[model samples]
Target: MSGSILNLFSLQGKTAIITGGTGGIGLAITTALAEAGANIISIEVPHDPASPLLRQAIEATGRKITVYDCNLKDHESIRATFHAIWASGSVPDILVNCAGITRHMKVEDTPVQDLDDVMAINFRGTYLCIQEFGRELLRLQRPGKIINFASIAAFLAQTNISAYCSSKAAVQNLTRAVSNEWAGKGITCNAICPGFIHTKMCEDLYTDKEFSARVVARTSMGRWGEPEDIRGLAVFLASAASDFITGESVFVDGGIMGR
Candidate 1:
C-alpha cells in the first residue's frame, strides 16, 4: 500500500475533546488519540484527582492536553468550558462523549431522581456537547468525528440498571439522529458499546470470583476486556480510517453479546 493510504489512520494536526477523559476507558481513549497525533482536551468534573494523572500521561507523549473542570450535568458549566476551549485556541476536529453515569436500581426500586440523574449525565450531557461543538464544526465547514459511549446494556437488559440501560439506548438513537441530520454538513456521529471492561467502575464485579467467572463464561473470548482493548477502535473511529462509517453502534464486548 502507498504511504498515503496507510496514513489515513494518522491524526496529525487534529484536535480532540474527550468528555470524562480522566479515568477508566476514557483515559485510555484519550491517550490513544493523543499518541496518534491529536491534541487532547479532556473535560472532567472539578476536583477529580485522576485528571492530573491523565494530563501528565498525555503530555508525556509530547502532545498537548488541556483539562477543563466542568460538570457534564450542568448546562452552564458545559457552555463555559466550550468558551474557554475556544479562547485557548484549540478547535476540536473530533469529539468523544465518554462521560456518563449509571445508577444500580431495579425498576421497582428505582427512584425518579435516580432516573433523572442518569438521563441528565448520560443522555442530555452527551447531546448538549455534541450540539454546541457540532455547530461550530459545521459552521467552519470542518469534517469532524463524534464518538458517543454507549453500553452493551443498551442491547441486553440487565438487572438493577434499568435507568442506565435506557439512557444508553437513548444515546445510541441520538447518535443516529445526529448523524442523519448532519451528514450533509461533513460530520460523522457514531456510538461505541462496550461490554464488561475492567475499569474502576466495574472493579466490584471483577472482585467477585463467582460473578467474574459467570461473566467470563458468557463471553466468547472467555475474559473481561482491558482498557487498552478499546484504544484501537477509538482511534480508528476518530481518524479518517472510519470516514465512511456513521450512525452505527460498534460493540467491543469480547463477543459476549453473541452468547
Candidate 2:
C-alpha cells in the first residue's frame, strides 16, 4: 500500500488526551496511541499516584507523554487543567474519556450518594472534558476524534451495578448526541463497550475461581479480555481510519454480546 493509504492509521504529529490513563485498560490504550506516533497527555486526579509502568511503556515507543493530575469531578479543576494544557502549546487532536468509577450495589441497597458519585465522574466528567476540549478544536477549525468509554453492561442488564449500568448507558447516548451536534464541525464521537476485561478493577472476580470460570464460559473466546485487547480499537477510533465512522458504539467484547 502507498504511504498515503497507510497514513490513515498513522497518528504522526497528533496529540491525544486520555482521562484515567494511569493504569489498566486506559494505560494500554495510551501506549498504543503513543506507538502510533501521537503525543499522549494522561489526566487523572491529584491523589492518584502516577504509574511508572505506563510512563516506561509510552517512553519505550519513543513518543512524548505528559501526566496531569486534575480532579474531573470538579469543574474548576478541569478548567484549570485545560488552561495548563493550552499553555503547554499542545492542543489535543483526540480525547478519550476513560476516567470512571463503579460501585457494586444492588438497586435497592445503592446509596443516593453512591449514585451521584458514579454519575459525577463517569457521565459528568466525560461531558465536561468533551465540552472544553471540543470547543478548542472547533475554534481552531480542526477535525478531532473523541472516544468515550462505555460498558457491555450498558447493553445488558447486570446485577448489583444499577448505577454503573445506567451511567455507561448514558455515556453511549451522550456519544451519539455529541456526534450529531459536532459531525458537521469535523468531529467524530464514538463509544467503546468492553466486556469483562481482566484489569485491577476486576481482580476480585478473577481471584474467585468459580466466578472466573463462569465469566470465561460466558465469553465465546473462552477467556477474559486483557487490557491490550482494547488497544487496537482505541487506536482505530482515534485515527483517520475511522473518520467516516461516527455516533457508533464499537464493542470490544470477546463475542460475549453475540452469545
RMSD of each: 1.1, 1.2
Off by over 4 Å in 1: none
Task: TM-score for candidate 2, please give it.
Answer: 0.96
For each candidate, what is the lDDT? Answer: 0.91, 0.91
Residues 1-259 of candidate 1: C-alpha lDDT, one tens digit per residue: 7998769888999999989898699989999999999998888888998977997889988999877889888999899888898888777699999998888767999888888999999999999999889878876788899999999999998999999999999999999999999888879999999999998889988999999999999999999999899999999999999998999999999998776
Provide TM-scores for the models.
Answer: 0.97, 0.96
| Residue-pair clashes per candidate | 0, 0
- Clash pairs of candidate 1? none
lDDT tens string, model 2, 1-259? 6988879999999999999888699888999999999999988777675567778889999999888888888999999998899888987699999988899977989999999999999999999999999989988899999999999999998999999999999999999999999999989999999999999988988999999999999999999999999998999999999999999998888999997
Model 2 misplaced regions, further than 4 Å: none
What lDDT is reached at residue 130 by model 1? Answer: 96
Error of 2 at 131 (Å): 0.4
The superposed Cα distance between candidate 2 and the true structure at residue 254, in angstroms, equals: 0.7
